[model samples]
Target: MRSLTEQDIRSSFVNCSKGEAKRLAIPRDLDERPWADLDFLGWRDPGAPDRSYLVTERAGRLVGIALRFPSSQRGFLHRSMCSLCLTTHPGNGVSLMTARKAGAAGREGNSVGIYMCTDLACPLYIRGKKVPEAGGRFEETLTTEQQLARMTDNLSAFLDKLHA
Candidate 1:
């Protein structure tokens, strides 16, 4: 997998809204599939066990991934980890995600799926990003770069398994 910058990722998303590509949380499965055609790229947010996230990937690299966890409860699903950040949320934060094979991914099976942070805040994690956990803002310990690297490493492993 190749290393990437913020722009390299946001540019591939046709659905970018404001600066949401960084905070809105998109999916890692890049190729487009009709909603009904998609098998594992999305999951019901545990909080709102009915809503799902939108997962996608960046162009020009196998490293960048995103997810859009829905905030509304209107569906059903199982528990899973977000392929990008590797942070597991309860049923509320976890969601199902997947993508199709094409381009360099054609032989990689028709699709790949993963669970993700329902809010899709991986950008912060990718670009030296992080938010204070719970009420521990002033006592936060992990550095931004540390957070980014951990996320990158975890995401890479997740995608690699999919390739295998």
Candidate 2:
């Protein structure tokens, strides 16, 4: 959970061409992002509503993914837990965040979705964000390791679900 730049996010993409990444229509207000408060960043492509982006730090380097739309949810998204940075959100937040599966997978049009926190605030959810609830999850339990585990588990589950 460190601060990231628009460039950093742009460069982390593994599935898209450098030119495509650079040319991607990024949000103009990059400077106004709550960098210090974000655990990771997620956004949808302006031109392609079906395309999306997510950035996170794994091991020490930054990693990003270009995700495609899920099968198609009519008003409601599927209910699954994110294994990466566990912190469940309403189905509204969970979406099929399949990377435009690269290589042959991409050729085969394979994609995977991630059930993620709607707000994408695993860090805040774990460390506690400015929720108004009096005795919510954060107030009752402030365990860091547990939070990390949930995050990891949520992401793992997401990966597993993609193949299932």
Candidate 3:
């Protein structure tokens, strides 16, 4: 992924009002992000832990979406797999992050969700830069590139549901 500017992110939102996008929190440490290793930029709002954001390039344009999850629904009893990266996380490490659909459907309260890394660090986990507390990645015959492609496909499918 390429490094993105604040303006780029604010303008990329597809599911929220322009004013809401303008007011939403943008990460402060943009320069510190591992852009080359990232498939998308995602972060939870510091002030509102239940609210999160994600931005990525799709079909030659940047697409951004706001997401939310039940903060109180922590998974402390068992391990769960992140649908995007296939990494298993124990406890509150995975969440059902949901995004409002784009256009009138979203206005009608339609939304889509997927089980994802709680920290929104699927790329890092897949690349071995971050490790889940439950265990390391499961041994797989696929290479890193294949893994990344799989993750991207998973995300694209979720995005497709939002448009559907």
Highest-scoring model, TM-score:
3
Better of 2 and 3 by TM-score: 3
lDDT of each: 0.43, 0.59, 0.92
Q: What is the TM-score of each candidate against the true structure?
A: 0.39, 0.66, 0.96
Regions more than 4 Å wrong, model 3: 73-75
Candidate closest to the true structure, highest lDDT:
3
lDDT per residue (tens digit) for residues 1-164 in model 3? 99999999999998999999999999999999999999999999998889999999999899999999988765466778899999988777888999999999999999999999989999999899998886457999999999999999999999889889
Task: Give the per-residue lDDT of model 2 (tens digit) for 95-114.
Answer: 55556554566557676655
Ranking by TM-score: 3, 2, 1
Stretches of model 1 off by over 4 angstroms after superposition: 1-83, 86-88, 104-109, 125-142, 159-164
Residue-level lDDT of model 1, residues 36-74, one tens digit each, is 322123333354433444333424332333333334453
**Residue pairs in candidate 3 whose N, alpha carbon or C atoms collide under 3 angstroms:** none
Worst 10 residues of 2 by lDDT: 131-140
Residue 27, model 1, lDDT:
37
Q: How far is candidate 2 from the true structure (C-alpha RMSD, Å)?
A: 4.7
